[model samples]
Structures are given as structure tokens and as C-alpha cells.
Target: MLEIKNLSYRVENADIVNSVDLLVPDRSFMVITGPNGGGKTSLAKLVMGISTPTGGSIFWDGQDITALSVTQRARLGISYGFQQPPRFKGMKVRDLLEIAAGEHISHDKACSYLTKVGLCARDYIERDVDSSLSGGEVKRIEIATVLARRCKLMIFDEPEAGIDLWSFARLTETFQEIHDRKEASILIISHQERIIRLADEIVLLAGGKITAKGSVDEVYPQIVSDTVAGCNRLEVKGAC
Candidate 1:
């Protein structure tokens, strides 16, 4: 299980994440959704060890890992995908997958991961993870690498970003498949309704705090209504 207690992060005396407590049980899927700039990404970074929290403790399976480095966290079967995935100019897609797995994976295994993200194996297997690939393609490829890692905890920061409608559908299916397997705990930061609906539990964060938390049936309606109202208000203000 992943446990966070009184987690807080501050910059220039502003709390980006404030006194957040969360628990992600094994083999479950959770979604964190909130308005833009609501600190969803920041919370994910803290969990991944990319950012240090000014207060509170992070525990994975009862071990205090708040001070562990990013690599140390990954070694503990934790994996994080960025909002904007980085590209390696000279790395082959296949090479990246094998490296993520920490051993040489076979062609079939690599293809399976790619297929999960709606990519054809032969088409992308030899391609460089560089400027040549579109943003969506690179995003999917990065997700494939995360799958290759087969981590105990998988955290994705907006996996649907830059993906096409068709690919987004495929991506959601992939998440469902992963959750169904009961192999790992999945935490996704997404505003997309499709992604949010897949979560076993949903958390609504705004202004660096969780304002709502519950199962999809309880939280989804509130989120949708609030989002629509907020957009309408924004439109009126913008028109004025």
C-alpha cells in the first residue's frame, strides 16, 4: 500500500500541497482530478520522489520513503510518467522498453506493451524516441515503457494529454485492463471524464486541498456539474 500523511509542499510561503493524507491500496485504481493549477501534478511528483515535501511522511508498504531519491523510489517498484514525456534523440523504442524492464525483453514482449497503447509493433519498434515522433506517439511510447517496468505503483500525470480521440479510447481500455489484472496500484492525474470514471476511487483537489473524495457514483456528478458551471462563469467573465 502507498500511504501519505500530512504531506505539504510550499514555495515562497505558498502551500502547493497542504496537509494531504491519502492511501492507495494494492491492486486498485485511483484518479486525482481538479482544476488546472490545482496542484494535482505537484502531488504526483511528491509521491514519485521528484519533489521533496516540506512536511509529512511517505510510506510504501510500511517503509518510510519520504527522503529516498527518485531512483530509489523506482527501485522500490514505483514508476512515474510525466505530463510532457521527454524524448531521447538516439534511443530506439525497443531499446527503451528493454532498459525500463532492466533486462533484454524479447520482440514479442516489447510488441505486447506497444499494442497495449494502440501502436503497431513493427512500425515503431525501430524508431528513435526523438523529434520524428508526434507528441501523442511519444506519449504513448513513454507509457509503454512504464508498463515495461511492471512497477508495484504506477503514477501517470495526464496520460491522455496530446493523444487523439481514438488513442484516448485505447488508453482508457489499457488502464482498465491493468486495473483488472490486479497487479499494481494505479494513480492517474487527469481531468478527462473517461479516465476519471475508471478509478475505483476519485479525489477532487482544488487550491492545494482535497475538497471531495468518494466512489465514482458519488463524486462524478458533482465534478461534472461544478466544471460546467465554472466554465460558464469563465465564459461570461471573458466576454465582459
Candidate 2:
């Protein structure tokens, strides 16, 4: 389980993430959503150790990991997929997947992960993760790496961004598969209804605070409702 207490981040003079507290239980799928500046991404970064929290503590499985570095956090089985995954000029897709797996993963295994993300293995397994590939393709590859890791807690920052409908459809199915199998505890930041529907619970964060958190039916209705303040309405999508 991941426990965040009084978590916060400050820059210049503003608090990007206030004294927020959240919990993601083991084997659960949780989605965090709110307006664009709700600090959803900042909270994810804090959890992944990409950015240090200026206050509060981050505990993973009951360990105080507030001061852990990004690499140290990864060693603890916490993986994060960036909103815009960086490209590697010379690294082949196969190499990246192997590195993510931390072993000499076979070509077949690497291809299987790619297929999970809706990409043909043969075409991409040997290709470089560079500018040659489209942004959407790059995003899929990064997602594939996170899946391949099979981390204890996987955090995805807007996995749907830059993805085509066909691929995004496949990606959503992949998330469902992982959830169904209890592959890992999942935390995703997205406002898309499709992704929200996948959440076992939804957390509404606005103004660096959790305005609400509960089951989809419990929290989602209020999110799209007109009366909620700072709702930052969802980018609605079809239901499952």
C-alpha cells in the first residue's frame, strides 16, 4: 500500500501540492482527476520521487520513503510513466524493454509486451526509440516498459494523451486486464471518462486538496455535475 500524509510541494511562492493525504491500497486501481491546475501531476511526481515533497511523508508498504531518490524509488518497485515520455535516439525498443525488466528478456517476451500496448512486435522491437517514431508511438512504448516492469505500484500520468483511438482502446483494455488479474496497485491521472470507469475508486483533487474520494458511482457524478466548484469537467467518453 502507498500512504501519503500531509504531502505538499512549493515553488517560488505557491504551493503546487498542498498538505494532501491519500492512500492507494494494494491491488487497487485508483484514478486522480480534477481541473488542469489541480496539481494531479505534481502529486504523482512526489510519489515517484521525481520531485521531493516539501512537507509530509511518503510511505510505501509502511516504509518512510519521503527522502528516496527516483532511482531508489524504482528499486522499491514504484514505476511512473511520464505525461510526455522522453525519446532515446539510439536505444532499440528491445533494449529498453529488457532494461525495464532488469534481465535478458527474450525477443518473444519483449514482443508480447508491445502487443499488449497494441503495437506489432516485429516492427518496433528492433526500432530505435527516437524522433523517428510518432509521439503516440513513443508513449505506447513507455507504457509497455512500465507494464513489463510489473512494479508493486504503477503510476501513469495521462496515458491517453497523444494516443490514437485504436491504440488508446487497446491500452484501456490492457489496463483492465491488469486490474482483473490483480497485477499491481495502479494509480492513473486522467479526466477521460473511459479511464475513470476503470478506477475501483476515484479521487477528486482540486486546489491541491482532495475535494472528494469514493467509488466511481459515488464520486464521478458529482465531478460532472454543474454544482461542484472547481470541477474542471471531464473529457467525457463512452462507458464500458
Candidate 3:
């Protein structure tokens, strides 16, 4: 289990994440959603050790990891996917996946991960992860690498951003498959209802605080009702 107690992040007297507490049970799928600037990404960064919390402690499976570095946390089986994934100018797609897996994966295994993200492995396996690929392509490729890691916990920041409709559909299916396997805990920061529906639990974070947290049936309806015009609202894609 992942336990966060009194977690807070402040910058220049502004609290990006304030006195928040959360628990992600083993093998659970949780989605964090709210209006933009709700500190969703910041919270994920803190959990992944990418951002240092000004106060509070983070514990993973009864281990005190509050002071661990990002690499240390990763070594403890935590993986984080960035909102704007980074690019490796001289690395082949296959190489990146292998590095993520910490082993030389077979061609078919590499292809399977690519396929899960809606990419044709043959076409991208040798391609350089550089400026040539579109933003959406890079995003999907980065997601595939995270899958390759097969860590104990996977945190994705806005996995749906920049993805096309078809690809997004495939991505959602992949997330479902991962959850069903019960191999790891998944935490995603996404506003897409399709992704939100996959969560075993939903956390509504606003103004750097957790406003609501519960099962989908318990919390989703209220969120849908709160949608308003001329404001950042949760997106409802496809037929309801």
C-alpha cells in the first residue's frame, strides 16, 4: 500500500498541495481529477519523488520513503510517466524499451508493448525518439516504456493528452488489462471520463486539497452535475 500523510508542497508561500492525505491500496486503480491547476500533477510528482514535499511523509509498503531520491524510489518499483514526456535524441525505440525493462526484451515482446499503445512496432522499433516523432507519438511511446517497466506502481500524468481517438480507445483498454492482472497499482491524473470510469476509486482534488474521494458510483455523478459552461470542466468523450 502507498500511504501519504499530511503531504504538502508550497512555493513562494503558495500551497500547490496542502495537508493532503491519501492511501492507494494494493493492486488498485485510482484516478485523480479536478479543474486545471488543482495540483494533480504536483501531487503525482511528490509521490514519485520528482518533487520534494515541504512537509509530511510518504510510505510505501510500510517503508519510510519520504527522503528517498527519484532514482531510489524507482529502484523500489515505482515508475512515473511525465505529462510532457522527454525525448532521447539518439535512442531507438527498442533501446528505450529495453532500458525501461532493465533487460534485452525479445522483438515480439517489444512489439506487444508498442501494440498496446496503438503503434506498429515494425515502424517505430528502429525509429529515433527525437524531434521527428510528433508530440502524441512521443507521449504514447513514453507510455509504452512505462508499461515495459512493469513496476509495482505506475503513475501516469494525463495519459490521454495529445492522443487521437483511436489511440485513446486502445490506451484505455490497455489500462483495463493492466488493472485486471492485479500486477501493480495504477495512479493516473486524467480528466477523460473513459479513463475515470476505469478507476476503482476517484479522488477529486481542487485548490491543492482533496475535496472528495470515493468509488465511481459514489462520486462520478456529482462530478458530472458540477460541469458548467465557460470554465474548465471534465470532458465527456464518446456516447454516455
Candidate 4:
């Protein structure tokens, strides 16, 4: 489980993330969502150790990890996927997957990970993780790398940001599969209703605070009604 208490992040006198409390239970899929600039990304960074918190504590599985570095957190079974994934100029796709796996993985295993993220394994297995790939391709590849790690807690920041509709559909399926497997606790930062509906619970963050929380059936309508600032107000689909 992941628990945060009174967390805050300030910069240039702005409370980017202020006094927030959250709990993500074991093997559950949760989504953190709000309008842009509402400190969603910053909160994720603080939890992942990408940024230092101004105050408060972070605990995972009863251990305090507030002072741990990013690597420390990763070593403790925490993994984060970037909103805008970075590229590796000279790294082969397979090489990157191997590093993420913490050991050499076979070509077939690597291909399976790629396939999970809706990528063609043979087409990308030997390619460089550089500027040559399109934004969507890079995004998917990054997700594949995260999957290779098989961490206990996976934090994904906007996994559907750069992908096409078809790819997004496939990506959602992958998320569903993850949730079904109970392999880990999933924390995804996304605003798409399509993605939000997948969460076992939804956290509505606004102005760096969680203003509302509940199951999709309870919170989805409230969000679509524009009850909070920074909300995307996406349309409901497929009888939802």
C-alpha cells in the first residue's frame, strides 16, 4: 500500500502540491486526475522522488521513503513512467528492456512486452530509442520498458497522451489485463474518461488537494458536470 500524509510542494511561493493525503491499497488500480497545472504531475514526482517535497511524509508498505532517491524508490519496487518519455540515442529497444528487467531477457520475451503495448516487436526490437521514432512509438516503447520491470507499484503519467485511437484502445486493454492479474498496485495519472473509467477508485485533485474521491459510478458524473476546476469534462461513452 502507498500512503501519503500532509504532502506539499512549493516553488516561487506557489503551493504546487499542498497538504494532500492519499491511500492506494494493495493490488488496486487508482487514477489521479484533475485539470492541467493542478499539481498532479508534481505530486507524482514527489512520490517517485523526482522532486523533493517541501513538507510531509510518504510511506509504502509501512516503510518511510520520503528521503529516498529515485533509484532508491525503484529498488524498493516503485516504477514511474513519464508523461513525456525520454529517448536513448544509442540504446537498442532490446537493450533497454534488458536493463529494465535487471537481466538479459530473450527476444521472444521482449517481443511479448512490446506486443502488450500494441507495438510490432520485430519492427522495433533492433531500433534505437532515439529521435527517429514518432511520439506515439516512443510512448509505447517506454510503457513496454516499465512492464519489463514488473515492479510492485507502477506509476504511469498519462500513458495515452501521444498514441492513436487504435493504440489507445489496445493500451486500455493492457491496463485492464494488469488490473485483472493482481500483479501489482497501479497508479495512473490521466484525465481521459476512457482511462478514468478503468480505475477501481478515482481521486479528484484540484489546487494540489484531493477534493473528492470514490468509485467511478459516484465520481464520474460529478466530474462530467464540471463540479471542479482543472477537470477535462470529457463525454461519457458506451452506456457509461
Candidate 5:
């Protein structure tokens, strides 16, 4: 379980994340949705300890982990997949998976992980994690790494960003598989309707604050209607 108590962060005299409190129970999938620059990514970073909270505390399973470093948090079963995955100049895909798995994973097991993200193991396992791989490919590999880690708490920031339609479908299935098979707690940040509908609970973040949070059936309709109306208004004014 993850408990965020009055968590707040500020930068350049502006509060990027306000005093927000949230609770994410175990074995559940939660989706955070909002427009761009709405603090969704910042909130994920704070949970992953990539950015420290200026106020309040973050408790994971009753332990105060607000001050723990990123590596320390990862050691305690927290994993974060970035919006833009980094390139590894000298690392092979197989090697990275092995490192993430933290054990000797056989070729079959490695293939299983890659296949979940729509990559053929024979083609990708030996490839280096460099610029040679396209953005979509690297993102999928990053997700595979997260699966290999098998963390209890996994946070994925905009997993659908660079993925094509075919790969996006595979990624959705992979997320569902993770929730169904491993019972992992997943916090996904995305604006895609399909992804949002998969959530057991939806958290709506706007202007660095949670405006609404509830089950999919409870919260999604309001968000969708409001967003569509806002878009139409913007189109009328030539702002979009």
C-alpha cells in the first residue's frame, strides 16, 4: 500500500504539487489522468523518489520513505518506468533484463518478457540499448525491464506515448496480465481512454491537485464529458 500525506512540492516559487493526500491500496491498478503540465509526471517522480517532496510524508507499507533515495526505494520494491527511456550505449537487451531481474534468467524467461511487449525475443534480446532502437521499441523494452524486476509497486509514466497502435494493444494486454497474474500495484499516467478504462480506480489531477478520484464507472464519464466540452470550446476560439 502507498499512503501520501499532505505531499507538496514547489519550484521557482511555484507549487508544482500542492498539498495532496492519496491512498493506493495493494493489488490494484490506478490511473492518473490530466492534461499536459498538470503535474501528473511530477507526482510520479515524487513517489519514485526522483524528486523529493518539500513537505509532508510518503509512506509505503507504513514506513516513512519520503527521504529515501531512488535506489533505496527500488530496493524496497518500487520501480519507475520513465516517460522517455534512457539509452544504454554498451548494454544489450538481455543483459539489461538480467540486471533488472536480479538473477540468472534463462533465454525462455527473457523471451516471455519481451514477447509481452510485442517484441520477438530472437530479434531484440541481442540488440544493444542504444539510439539504434526506435523510441517505441525502447519504451517497450523499458516496460519489459519493469516486468523483469517484478516490483510490488510499479509506476509507468505515459507508457502509450510513442507506441504504435499494434504495440499499444500489446502493451494494454501486458498491463492487464501484470495486474491479473502478479497482482502488482500499478500506477499508470496516461490520457488514453482505453488505458483509463482498465483502471480499477481513476485519479484526476489538474493544476497540481486531485480534483476527483473514484472507480472507473464513477469518475470517467465526468472527465470525458468535461474534456470534450473544453476541447470544443478551445476549437471555437482557435486555441487548439
Candidate 6:
């Protein structure tokens, strides 16, 4: 389980994340959704220790981990997939998978992970992870690495970004399989409706604060209503 207490962060005199508290139960999926620049990404970054909180505490299974580094957090079973995955200059796909899996995975096992992310193992396992791969391909490969790690807590920042329609559909099923088989705690920051529907709980953020958090039926309606109303207002002003 993960507990965030009074978490707050600021940058250049702008409060990006306010005093927000969230409790994520173990073995469940939590989806964070909001408009762009609403601080959903910042909250995820703070949890992953990519950015330090200006104030507050983060507890993992009852242990305080607010001051821990990103590597330390990873060692404690936390994994984060970035919005833009980094390129590996000379690393082969197979080598990266082996490192993530922490063992010599058989071609079959490696293929299974790659296939889940819409990649063919025979073609990709030997390829280099560099600028040669497309953004969508790199994103899928990073997700495969996360699956290989088998971490207790996995955070995906917009897994559907840069992927084709078909790949996005496949990615949703992969997440479902991970939740069902691994039973790991999954936190996804996404605006996709299909992805949001897969969540056990939906957390809504606006202006660096959680305006609503609850089960799908309890919270989704509010999001849809607010979004439609906002769009209508914008259209009336010729902004949309």
C-alpha cells in the first residue's frame, strides 16, 4: 500500500502540486486524470521521486520514503515509465530485457513480454534501443521492461501516447492481464476514456488539487459532465 500525506510541490513560485493526500490500496489500479497542466504528471513524478515535494510525507507499507532517491524507491518495488522514454545509445533490446528481468530469460519468455506490447520478438530482440525506433515503439519497449521487472508498484505516464489505434487497444488488454495475473499495484496517469474505465478508483485533479476521488461510477460522471460543459463554454467563445 502507498500513502501520500499532505503532499505539496512548487517550481519558480508556482504551486504545481498542492497539499494532496491519497491512499492507494495494494493490488489495485488507480487512474489519475485531469486536463493538461493540472498537476497530474507532477503528482506522479513526486511519487516516483523524480521531483522532491516541497512539503509532505510519502509512506510505503508504513515506512517513510519521502526523502528516498529514485533508485532507492525502485529498490523498494516502485517503477515509473516516463512520458518520454530515454534512448539507449548502444544497448540491444535483448540486453535491456535481460537486465530488467534480472535473469537470462528464454526467447519464448522474452517473446511473450514483447508480444504483449505489440512487438515481434524475432525482429526486435536483436535491435538496438536508439533513435532508430519510433516513439511508439520505444514506449512499448519501456512497458515491456516494466513487465519484466515485476515491480510491486508500477506507474505508467500516458502509456497510450504516441501509439497507433490498434496498439492502444492491445495495450489496454496487456494492462488487464498484468492486473489479473501479477496483482501488482498499478497507477496510470491518462486521459483516455478506455484507460480510465479500467481503474478501480479514479482521482481527479484540477489546479494542483484533487477535486474528486472515488470509484468509477461515483466520479466518472462528474468528469464527463465538467468536460462537456467546459467544451461548450469554449465553443461559445470561439475557442474550440
Task: Give the best candidate by TM-score.
Answer: 3
Q: Give the better candidate number (2 or 3) by lDDT.
A: 3
Q: How many residue pairs clash in each candidate?
A: 0, 0, 0, 1, 0, 0
Native-referenced Cα lDDT, model 2: 0.91
> What is candidate 2's lDDT per residue for 1-240, written digit by digit as tens?
999999999998788899998999999999999878889999999999888888999999999999999999999999999998999989999999999999998889999999999999989999999999999999999999999998999999999998999999999999999999998999999978999999999998877888899999999788878333543444222211
Off by over 4 Å in 5: 228-240
Q: Per-residue lDDT of 1-240 in model 3, one digit per residue for the tens?
A: 899999999999999999999999999999999888899999999999989999999999999999999989998999999999999999999999999999989999999999999998899999999999999999999999999999999999999999999999999999999999998999999989999999999999988899889999988987877665635344332313
Residue range with the least summed lDDT across 10 consecutive positions in model 3: 231-240
The local lDDT score (0 to 100) that residue 148 gets in candidate 2 is 90
Q: lDDT per residue, candidate 6, 1-240, as tens digits?
A: 999999999889988999999999999999998877789889989999999999999999999999999989988999988888998989988888888888999988888889988887898999999999999999999988988888899999999999999889888998998788756999999989999999999998877888899999999888877766456321132455
lDDT of 4 by residue, 120-208 (tens): 89999999999999999999999999999999999999998989998899899999998999999999999799999999999988778
With a 3 Å backbone cut-off (N, CA, C), the pairs that clash in candidate 1 are none
In model 3, the runs with Cα more than 4 Å from the true position are: 232-240
Residues 33-52, candidate 1, lDDT per residue (tens digit)?
88888889999999999999
Worst 10 residues of 1 by lDDT: 231-240
Instruction: Give the number of the best model, judged by lDDT.
Output: 3
Please provide TM-scores, in order, for all candidate models, with all chains considered together.
0.94, 0.94, 0.95, 0.94, 0.94, 0.93
Count: clashes, candidate 4: 1
Q: Candidate 5 clashing pairs?
A: none
- What's the CA RMSD for each of the models? 2.6, 4.6, 4.3, 4.7, 2.6, 2.8
- In model 1, how large is the Cα lDDT of residue 112? 93
Which pairs of residues collide in model 2? none
Error of 5 at 165 (Å): 1.4
Residue pairs with backbone overlap in model 3: none
Q: Assess candidate 4 and give its lDDT.
A: 0.91
Model 6 TM-score is 0.93
- lDDT accuracy of residue 152 in candidate 2: 91
Q: Among all windows of ten consecutive residues in candidate 2, which has the lowest summed lDDT?
A: 231-240
Any runs in candidate 4 off by more than 4 Å, and if so which?
Answer: 227-240
